[model samples]
Target: MKKNILYLSIAVIIGLIGGYLIFGNSSDSSNQKITEVHDHSEDSTNEMWTCSMHPQIMQQEPGDCPICGMELIPAEASSEGLLANQIQMTENAMALANIETTIVGNLMEGNDDGVISLSGKIATNEENNAIQASYFDGRLEKLNVSFEGQVVKRGQLLATIYSPNLVAAQQELITATSLKQSQPALYKAVRNKLKLWKLSASQIDNIESTGEVRENFPLYATVSGTVAMVMAAEGDYLKQGQPILKVSNLNSVWAEFDAYENQISQFKKGQKIKVATSAYPKKEFDAVISFIDPVLNSSTRTVTVRSTLKNNENLFKPGMFVSGKIKGTAQSAEESLNIPASAVLWTGERSLVYVKPNPNRPVFEMREVTVGLRNGDNFTVVSGLENGEEIVTNGTFTVDAAAQLQGKKSMMNKSGEKTMTGHEGHLGMQGDSENKSDAISTMKMKLPMAFQTAFQAALKPYFKMGDAFVASDASQVSALAKTVLAKMKAIEVGGLGKMEKSHLSKSIAMLDAISSSSDLEKQRAQLVVLNENTVALAMNIKSPTETLYVQKCPMANGNKGAIWLSTEKEIKNPYYGDDMLTCGSVIDSLK
Candidate 1:
């Protein structure tokens, strides 16, 4: 609920604070116009609105934002800076996003050392674990330890069993007793044989003194611990040395963390680590790294680093997600310059951050930095930064987005100048293929070639699903959705920018929803949103080799209109299939 309000407050804060800042000493009538300011032309006052969260949506009148369902607010365009790669944001916009910045100093000048963060989970202490098993073959007559997590004590009565072997052994003792006078050696051997089966000496003496045979016997607990698993059931036949329960001592537990292959050299046994858990967020438990796995996990490329934690207070539970913080990443005696991890945008081998050239203004420009040793949530900047510089520590994505919108240098657009194709409409919706316009006013950045080429390959199955949808074959759509989803998942996201990642993630989610159901209407409904995101993604591709046309059907999405990408300029409507085949116009193309 609070998150929803925060999103809504962005527009409200911008409208209120921005209205006063832009038009001070204005009349109440002029201030009222701020809520629904006109776009397109000066005479078109209150005639249009756009989404606050999604700026792509531009409608003729006020309505709920189609993408996020938030109420539409009047759109405002801001001018870019004259300097290269520089962009500015209004104080209202900054306040609306709740963006914050921090001035970083060289850690090399300070005495503080960096800390390493590790992700792991709590596990049982394996050394203290034991198995409780039966000593001899028998039928379980009764079981006292019936459930997992049950506590047991040493020498406690655990179960009762009926053993035919013990019954026959008793008969042997009875028969041997008669010959004891003549065969004292046989008597001694029979008594010692019962001991091998874990029978008490008193039990052997009772049968001999009473001259009777016992069919049932009691089993006792061998160790004291909490039962981790119950392996046996009442009335079940048990074999000799068969396990009945798995028990583990809870006095101490193991906090095992998976350290990446690159981070393995920094970790060593006997190093002190401070562990924190979600259950106890405020507290940190001190533990020593007792063991590190000798072999690295081949698939995960990580090694298990184990720490023994005392749970005398019963604070830790097995399977709880935990984090381990290790200090001392600083190799140099003098601490190096470090900034919060959030301040850096890491893409492949490069690290980028938005630096405020002037400390007093909201101006920001992207800078590529060389990062060295990383400690916990901070990274040491080896180059491209200076002490006393203010960098964006939060809302880095927002700032990058603002830069891209203003045609300034961004994570996606590394160049200081705009790159454009003479295409009409921002999202390929304003003009048909026959009437393509040369208006290239918007920031003309395209998705990187590596990402675009990979995505194009993955979208092959997606286009096939569109064909299936055009044929009204729900089953084929479901199958193709799964195929495309797999291909999409296989796409390498290591070098993709944040915006590309978001679009790809959303497209994958839409495909998942489409494949989960076999209903044609439901699949088409998901396709509507899928096409929107994919179409936006396709707009980012620069000079694509494969031809892809953005086709739109006016009657789709309940008359709100929708667009889909196709390989050819010829439109085949997937929304209505046979009902409205070839009903769409080609709005844009990628070639």
Candidate 2:
């Protein structure tokens, strides 16, 4: 009877403990669910609708714009919504987008001096030039403005012309003076005829008094300036209505500058420019924009900008090399955000950038921004982003790829529904599957020619060396390896894409192995091994991936050109083993 009673008490204790644990767990679960539900509901209620083209307008509900009938887009929940065209993304999506943020302070003021100096040469002001020509028929005589660079004043004697026509008119006047009594009307008509030849009244009176015709007549200057050119010198036969001299006002000069096509918009009329010259290093002359060439130079692909400078001390001379800083105001007067030019993805029509939303999570979204003035590598942000927002300045392509994967409007697409292929894989981090999707989209954008050349040049040497090794040619292999090193050393790889750098890095590493080989046999053997690896890499390599053919190629002596890529395997070459591929691979490869 006592054992049964102990068992009953233990069972009762166990039941009570089970009941207490189940109820306590249920209460905590209910509280957690309630908290989550409250946060989700708050987010749903605060959602806003905005126009993609007009981000400043915000509406509580989704609808068409009263002004423009364009569809409304969803606004980001964070401060990103305040930006121009911020596209919100999830944490995982952001990681795939490669959206990176950095902390930066506002530029309260900029230094008066420009960070970069542009050099150009001084030239004649075409607008202030004049050409002197004869108004009447003339012959060989004398020229006052004998040579170029001679100064002349207004009404000054330019040259003396001997004209048979003028001599005949003078004789008529003298004859008329003697025959005045016989024919007064005929004398008056003869006298008036001489006036039509641009003769002075004093010269006519001298002709009548002397009763003889002068062989040579003097010509006077129309305008005062420095003689730029003397077409006719002393004792040269001259014709009627022919240019005699070319003159220009030296008081004002033109400083012509060649601006890159990308920077043409930054220059305009009436803007201020501070000019200095290596010839006169101590002097800093001030000038203002007077004219900009309407057309771009087809050969140089640059725009010509002309600034007018007053040459008070005759310090500015034509053809003198000069350096200067241009102080230009933003095209838009309204205050707007500014970011590094490297942050923008220019797609010809629209400009895009990735803005970090959460600094703690390092999350960002793709945003379409309007740009105003492009001052060097920096641009003025007219719209699309707000102050205090984190932006991706470096590795913009990396972040743009991530955006494409997330189905957000990226540098390539806005809907994010399209799959972009055929992009040359550049260098950078690959986060996950989603990151790959985004990277593929971002790669669709075309890169600058300079960047493409740099990427390919890096891989040329490695591939060449690897091919040489595979062929079992010890001398050729050694030469090829050394050539790769020389090419890499000579190549200027300072600025390039991330994908390009990654491929080049791999190719360069392989070249480094070849370089360290002590003997020809050893180098050949290593190259053979490298060749197998390179072939394998080529099979798997994707388009839009950095390759050497676009930048660099092999050389006859195995040495690379001065401007080459660091890697060699990434070069996409069809003539891998073809003889004489190196000699003409690149144009002017020495430096």
Candidate 3:
């Protein structure tokens, strides 16, 4: 009975301990699973969105970046919340920033002629000039065609000249006529003498028959045309073989043109050319090249090309300025893209054009193009683009500005350095340096807000009082000018496309001029103009991105300027000139 009772107790205790161990393990496992679920949720909340190359992008949801087409990453939530300086924008703001995209298409294209407008002076055709000269020594006793541009006809009597030589020749012919009755051989000799004096056979016969001497002889017009040169006047003595007047036949005139050395090859004899004159702006006359001068003019760096035209109305006169075009065919195949010269942003070495994926969107992408022969205003794209690409023509400058702000490729490098591209370097600038004073006057007289700020500070010294600058002080003046310039650089004046950094480079160069200025009065005068120009440029500036695209600092020798003073990673801007420096920013949030 005792052994059976002990066995029952042992069974009950063992059963109780086994049940406790099993229940404890089950509760621990349940707690662990709950913690795992919570950790997983936290991880999902902290997920980030980033680009494969540009990790700066941060998005709440998964999407592709408009700039690089990379998958977006989730932003890492900061313990401090959103930074005050950060560009945290709503979806609407993003749209206003023009952060949009479009699809590309393919299509056929036609060859377009580029119309190059060159400002030139009007001139007369040199070959059409006529000079009338006295055939014998005589005195001009009367005048017929007096003033310049007098029209005359062929064989018309221009002037009567009293000539002793003519009288002597007529007497010799009479003597020969008298001697003919006695000695025929001596008569031939006297007839030859009169002929040597330029006496015609009819005049000789009349003089011989009448036995009279005419003192004044009538000079006939050599050609039927306008008198181009009049050398002899009434009462003026003219020598033998001396030119007294010039007449040209306007029935046909030669159009002489200056052909540049490079363009000389395009011209061939008998090729058709179309000529236009400012005087006759609406009319176009056709001419055929009769000759291309074999020799090139070293001084003008051109070859002379001659084209003949019929001047039936006598409208195309000698010395009348005219311009003409000759169509040239290229040996190679035509290009894929067509663009206007104005559409390209010249960066010194490379030609850049902005392409819009969609016309509805204001933004665009920068494409470096290989240019072929320029027909006129249009440039043929030998490579770098396809057909049906929409290019920005009128508002290229505006589009370029937006690209620069968005940190995309631009016409110039960050240092404001330019690239060499085709014949674009030869084209004139938007602001020509030839008329510096005119451009400066236009800027200062208007006094736009940005220009006022930039110029006021830059010209403060000059405005306050006369100042002198030496070459040694050039760098110092540059520093002061840089201060105001930096501020002006941040502003966007228009929406043309993109601004070339070179445009601003000229403004920056003014600072160097200020430093080197030695004469107070002279330097001050120049500085005034410079200040006005700076102000005007500030007002007209289109994009701050231009500064980034061409960040060329003149002092590039280790002390050179930087494209971005700080890396894209850094959030603070030491370069910002105003409180609104970050306004309208179109950048991705940092993860």
The model with the greatest lDDT is 1
Can you rank all candidates by TM-score, best first?
1, 3, 2
Which stretches of candidate 1 lie above 4 Å from their native place? 1-84, 106-112, 178-189, 276-284, 297-302, 312-315, 320-323, 332-334, 346-349, 370-376, 414-591
Question: For candidate 2, lDDT tens digit of each residue in 408-472?
Answer: 56655655663331122321112343322111112322345554444345456555655654355
Alpha-carbon TM-score of each model against the true structure:
0.59, 0.44, 0.49
RMSD of each: 19.8, 20.3, 19.4
Instruction: Please give the CA lDDT of all the candidate structures.
Output: 0.75, 0.58, 0.51
Model 2 residue runs over 4 Å out of place are 1-109, 112-128, 139-150, 153-162, 177-220, 228-240, 253-309, 318-334, 357-365, 375-377, 395-409, 417-591
RMSD of 1: 19.8
Weakest ten-residue segment in model 3 by summed lDDT: 421-430
Q: Report backbone clashes per prediction.
A: 4, 36, 48
lDDT of 3 at 59: 61
lDDT over C-alpha atoms for residue 236 of model 1: 91
Q: For residues 468-536, write the lDDT of model 1, one tens digit per residue.
A: 999998767876886787677667777665546656775776675676455799788779767866777
